[model samples]
Target: MSTESLGHNSVDARSNGLFGVYVHWPFCAAKCPYCDFNSHVHRGAFDEAHYVEAYAQELAHFAKHTQGRVVQSVFFGGGTPSLMDPRSVGGILDAIAKHWIVDPKAEITLEANPTSVEADRFRGYRAAGVNRVSLGVQSLREGPLAELGRKHTVDEAIAAVRLAQSIFPRTSFDLIYARPRQTLDEWQDELTEALWIAQGHLSLYQLTIEMGTRYYDLFRAGKLKMPDEDLSADFYEMTQEMTQKAGLPAYEISNHARPGQESRHNLIYWRYGEYVGVGPGAHGRLLINNQRHATATEKLPFEWEKRVHARGHGMVTDDVLTWEEEGDELLVMGLRLREGIDPARFAKLSGRKISDRQINELKAIGFVETLPNGFIRVTDKGWPVLDAVVADLAA
Candidate 1:
């Protein structure tokens, strides 16, 4: 089979937007203190075969609603999708092909952790039709890695990245910044190393404390000291400057990619295109019977499987969205891109145009700028306060 072509072209992306499938693998070896995602750590025996069957069944159920739509991307996200046997991954892909007309050029990605054990599966994943790998190499320093509860050493992380680059057509890694006690110079050095080793894409995120996590409890107890707002702003600005200088500009608030090497799967979400989320604790948006519906499944792994076996799918929520809600979602998601939102598209979805008064107010303050093509984008000056800008426009 021919490998999917790689290029960073927005026209092709927009023209080909279709269904993106997100399959969640919710098991992890250990849970990170800062994570609030719906992931669980199972020390007992795992049943990969059983979960594979459940995924196939749920996908078949979704196919009935999304018939005739060509699939443009498939992403395996996880507590640890890398932990699954490659054969299982292949089985899921085969099931997807059975139900949908998967575009030959569709991008297939799997999220992995940078550890030797996981690295050992790189070739297996490649054989299973995964053309892209996103590594969770959160930091390059040992102290921070230990603090973050990551099992991999910095050396192991780098080695895994090298091994992944050798096997995958596209590679990307994630880094968490604004960490406690991290100096700006230290972060600069770390980022320099990251850029030196980076391939086509990188996801740089600032650490945020979420409720119901260990970090949140520690923070509430005043044990975890994160960067202050002023310092975090400095870190954000420096990141933009470094990444832009390295020729990998910010395509979204937290993602940097070589012009066409952007993750097509993620783009579907940011662009508000339809997607089907399968497996445990996954969420999806789809056009069902001419109405946009939001869907979510049971988060517990075994429970989800039982639900699927009993009722064809494990979905617990399937609320149809109002046009006003769709417009709000469009505004919230589209503004994250550097390319910004098309007012015409927004008007089409919302039935009301964005207030000219708000646009002028934002433009006058240098928070936003209008392109020659008429799309309105948040300025570099405006990105730090993106939420406020979107809320203003949406209001």
Candidate 2:
């Protein structure tokens, strides 16, 4: 990794050992109809070179408060990180190592689309310090992909996963389920096929209608037909049953992995650890000098770059957490994991015990069960009913 200062920024590494860095690349070949992530498709031009510099500048800004705090992981997530030049990624990694005490075994993961244009960057990413790869192979079947607005062919997805496994020892890919008219038999066969190709991990999600997406618009117009709740519930239960038998049990809501192969980067978020977010519209959570903070950068490309050039930051907001805010954040994120919350960990952030009244209410409702190990966990029975539980608990 090579190094450079995009601009002047001070660093203080003794913040805490609970830190990590996130770099966002905000361009995708095409935005899926259902994808509401901060991604866009370019028609004419993109300033990749200048965008890379902006990322380093933003990182330099945060590293000051995060010096000596061990970077537990670095996730290259986005529009499509695979679209980035290997040199740009290399330069960023070098700069990170220079300013922060990055753990040598730090988990570095890159999210990629399976097209040849992006897949070809795998080896370069590995060379650039990314040891793990999460390919967005959203479907193993072609029809669902076409319906979902993805560009790659099924064969292309298969090839990309195979290539990724060859290049990196740890690989994870995703599959979207619960499509309209998709039967249990069809999805069961696909899952069977996926497991044959799966390596150490997988992320399988039940499709949901996000408000601003194209699907949502069509849904509002009543032109699109989606699976009913009953059918969707069956698909969700089937996924849990199948994945558990395959030995890659669900570690979080939608993520599954073999023992010790869980996604370290995602765990950073689910575990409520600190990380730096750089790039258009990326949000990060950090704790600095005993104060927890939420950070988000400017969302537009031109605006983010200009802001970075001016004040050496593109931050849209930098906010410290209130006790109620911290509790809400902790409960929401903590429940995403199968392990639920470690009471002591909750106490560390909120400086108060988790309410036994609330715990008893949830247990009584069959939403969560107390474990013998002293960790509270969501029950398999409560998986589908999670949103209601979270909302009531928060209320």
Candidate 3:
């Protein structure tokens, strides 16, 4: 469908509501020891043009199912989306605009590494319609940078951030705290520097050893030193206090942003909005035939490409969620936001109300509280045990 014809339809597929498109680029220059994401390092050259074509076909395939939706955001996430040629990025975007009525003010973001080479393309990405950039600057310390398998130096990371801020309308960078033997004082100093460099957004994540990563193997072998439970709690509290004081408060548990600078693409996921995922290994939540369905694509890159060419899409799973499953997912995602969940919405999704006895018991222990407007949220005291709180409420 042409953009003009698509625009003429006033029915929004879900207009007045949140909808998004996520494009996953699964190639990375190198894999980090701590990451378990679906990323690969190709030893030889591959056809970038062919892959871009697959992405376009997949977008068209989804467009047929979600016709007339006004896309509120488009995110180019990856193993490393910055590695993509600017023309490829532009091609994928053109395909998106071809199939749907992309909102004029839609937030378009790309995730990039902080290498100088990638930073040089910031202007090109901007020219191609990407208005936001999120850099993977895991650390500012030289020692930790090496330990984390990051190729960029601290100086290079800072330079990239500065360059991105100058080029993009919005920018954000990530930092991983709670590293081995990281003192509270050192983190305070480092984060202070980061806030000074930050223009509007920061994603501060605590280090955790997930299975299938090198860090997990090291931890199992007792070769890795992790902070004890108490120290980790101290780190979390310090992070909350410092970012809140910097006016970039934690809108979600791991993401902090200046008012109105929050990542709109990510908000779609956390707020339980529908989105279509394109590309290998991407997962999506979509509203189909008035039912919420969970969809996933093949994880292997070449296999996914072959499937896309064979059947016009690479989707391997599309399960319709039960009402109870919908309620559970809403809690799993919505509770991550400081704004919390609506009891009425939960009842509507689940066909049953959350147990009042559970809420009262948790509140008695200072784990949760009802807002002045009747929204229920986990208190700071409860954030450390958020999973338990959600489980109790959902049960």
Candidate 4:
């Protein structure tokens, strides 16, 4: 497979079928205050060898149900997958290859932090067959980094990114904006610097206080203040303007990439393609017996390992979705892309069409627009209130 057109455009809603595999590494060096992800910080040495064996077992189990499917992408996401030994990553990738026909040009990515310690393993990971690495560089400023409880300094993050660029075929980093007390000018400066150093892809996310996170408690206690909606909107607009000017445009709500440089793993999800999610707290969507099924596993790392050992797979939920539910989910995921949702596909899935009343009303207000290909996308005016738009259309 050629690499030239892999990231050229968003996945076609009606075609470009994709299959992916996601492996979650549930261990973090230190838990961030604002993260609600199922990542645990282990004080004592854990059984890395045991976990690797369990992962292989789980992959074999999934392969049984998904035989003959070709995997186009594999993503190692987590509490911090970089914490795992590079050899362990290699073993898992090997297991995947043993079961499924992994595309030779498949996008294999590993999520990492930018601490110097973790960056030291970049070459090892490259040798392990990970062609892409996404760094968790939440901020470029010391103040925000400290506030976010990140261990790496801005200097370290930049160095790690440069190093990854040197080692991997592709590299991307993340940034959090709309943070407490962050000014527009400050973000613009930071983002400008980020773009200058960025290779092709970036993920700029607006901070949200999720339930059960320490940030949520602080927010409720009046100790932390998020950017006001108006200010946050301004930040969002500024981000779009700056990234577009830099040649990377918003391909998804929070993800920006040059044409064809988008993350293929995430595209699998947004395109509503089939993928198996293995690891604790991982979620999967698979098509079996002519129906799409949603799958989730136990959240506890050790518990999931035990279940995988005992039951061959650690799935806790395997609910077959109804056509209506598939339609709603398709709309929800598809509309997130700049490419938008294919109305004909939605109708085919739901056995009905999206309300013309809803589409016309939104179009009249400049909140949604139809593509020449008959796809529908949220406009800049609608992105800020995307949930409402999706609900109105789905309803």
Candidate 5:
């Protein structure tokens, strides 16, 4: 495609007013047993150059549709972006700049496994324009790391975090709590240490077995023991309390950050802003012709590459969402934020207002509350049953 043809089309007044890009690098050194993300462990020789070229092509294709949009955030999510050569990461960022107007202060984040080997590449990634790094330090204990199929040990993970903090402008790491046989006291100790080590942000998630994961099979076979409902609730509450006391409050359901340290890229998603997703199994929401289109690329890595080579894009589906669908999506994503959703925006997008009776009922039951600023958000009591609350509101 010619550069001229990829330039911005006529601007739409009904745009979401924010835009970003998501690049999916779908390769991993080893697949975690609990992971259901679209990541594959390739056995044969991989051609990094060819993959990089395909990414450039696919990005150019997306640029044609989303021209003139200033990129506020560019996320390199993965299988493990740290596995990539820094030059490859640089090549993709260069491609994005070539196609779109990247903001000078755009948050360029790359997800990484906290292995010592990958941590060695920290300086290279920082030199290549990655301002932020989110490490996959799933556990700080050896036994749980092994159980989760993570290749890094506790010492290595901590070292990686320290190294990343020294190298990058912003750094965040994740941890999984409420594992089988885990006690509340143990978790409190662990979280206390995590809070002490955390620089500005942390992602703490409760372990849940998803179908098609090895953990799910083990759970179904009764070989895995998970925390029961009450204990899980205790874990969640304690996590909230500790993180809040540590000065990193929960910004979303699973994310915590100090003031102004929230992940801007993820906030784009939670705020229902527009983004282009390029690469295998990536999904995007774009505003086109005054309508929101949901797009998804082919899932298989090699197949997506082939499609991109042939068609300049790897998209497998592009559906124009209805107003109701748009409103529902806004509710689903926006409610996860502490700032909550704007009912006016919801009405503008969905063409209807939320039922007052439903809101009154939920408020009476203490599931949700209307902020003084006129935004509606799930309360602490409501977060445990968030899906049900959303369902009721949507209904």
Candidate 6:
């Protein structure tokens, strides 16, 4: 029942692997200028009790959708879930476990920034059920951190990473590369330093000027000066070289880890597997019986909380995927993995074969190759230009 393209939905078939949960705690101490994620800053008194109940209700709603499947993972994502009270994290996890069948070795992860205040809560989080931690140590140098608008310093990041390693054996951190005025040599040195300290995995992102982000505005206003494209490419090459030498391979375009240490939660998405998403702005794709369901939850906290209080639920949108839409979705998500897409899975998802016309065109352009089993994958030459290639395949 494993799928390549459309996605196979026959095994557990009904299981559709529809049992992972994601919790979004959307409050940050400060929003970075370059960030475009759904995050807001707040330090005043708010409804912690009400918020915890809302989270519980969201879990209950998903429990109804996925009645008997075992949840493989539960991820507590940003705006800094670490800022939450450890008790709140526990309450929600307890609710999920009570309401659903969680895998015995379920991987529970929390995303945190490197502030000491958050670090102090690490042990409490482990006690609460978090077995993995992904620290947001965007940069380790003082100037680079300030440029990225991070709240912590190099020493503080090191300290937080050390604390996380001490608490959770599976710890990882992210580093943003290709910044304005950043040199390849600088990144090489910095990466070398970070790699020396990384516990198991490292997420390296090439900074891009995303629309509506402060970085984009600054660049458009001629205020954000960055390295040229050539320089950025140079730095990416250096990153690959250094990371491979460190025994961490880039399993995804942006994530690298020691063998078998890849983020299983994220793999579910990139591998185009089914998962349930809860909380504000979270998304999920699930398959039940033989149908696909797309899920989304409330965005603003007030709107979400109101729904929670009124009907014991807070959701924004949920829709079924059209066959063509499912095809497009598979094409988009499948390419993120190194294994590429399986044509048979596509055939199963769409109940029809992928046309040789498009496949031939992509192959002619050196973007795709077919395995003996007819599974297709993006070639190494296609990785640097992946977005355009996905667009072509989807189109």
Instruction: Give lDDT for model 5.
Output: 0.92
Q: lDDT of all the models against the reference?
A: 0.91, 0.83, 0.91, 0.91, 0.92, 0.82
Per-residue lDDT of model 2, residues 1-395, tens digit only: 01142222233231224567888888888889889998878777766777788778878887766655677888889888898898899988887888888888889888999987788888898898889999899889988899888889999999999999999979999999887678999999999999889989999998888999998998899988888988988998999999999999999989999999999888877777778888889898766656667889888877888999887888888887886677677778778899887776666666677778877898997889887888877788887887776666666
- Per-residue lDDT value at 187 in model 4: 98
| Candidate 2, RMSD to the unseen true structure | 3.9
Backbone clash numbers for all candidates listed: 2, 4, 0, 2, 0, 7
RMSD of each: 5.6, 3.9, 3.4, 5.6, 2.0, 4.1
Of the candidates shown, which would achieve the greatest TM-score relative to the real structure? Answer: 5
Q: Which residue runs does candidate 2 get wrong by more than 4 Å?
A: 1-16
Clashing pairs in 2: 11-64, 12-64, 13-67, 13-68
TM-score of 2: 0.94
Model 5: residues >4 Å from true position, as ranges? 1-10
lDDT of 1 by residue, 187-284 (tens): 99999999999989999999999999999999999999999989999999999999999999999999999999999999999888889999999999
- Measured by lDDT, the strongest candidate is 5
Candidate 5 lDDT, tens digit per residue, 169-215?
Answer: 89999999999999999899889999999999999999999999999
Better of 2 and 4 by lDDT: 4
Residue 296's lDDT in candidate 2: 90
lDDT of 3 by residue, 1-395 (tens): 12322223324332227889999999999999999999999878999998899999999888877777889999999899999999899999999999999999999999999999999998999999999999999999999999999999999999999999999999999999999889999999999999999989999999999999999999999999999999999999999999999999999989999999999999999888889999999998877556676889999999999999998899998887899998998899988889998888888878899999999999999999999989899999998899999999999
- What lDDT, from 0 to 1, does candidate 3 have? 0.91
State which candidate, 2 or 6, has the greater TM-score: 2
Cα lDDT of model 6 by residue, 91-112, tens digit? 9899999987889888899999
Tell me each candidate's TM-score. 0.95, 0.94, 0.96, 0.96, 0.97, 0.93
Using alpha carbons, what is the TM-score of model 3? 0.96
Task: Spell out the clash pairs found in candidate 3.
Answer: none
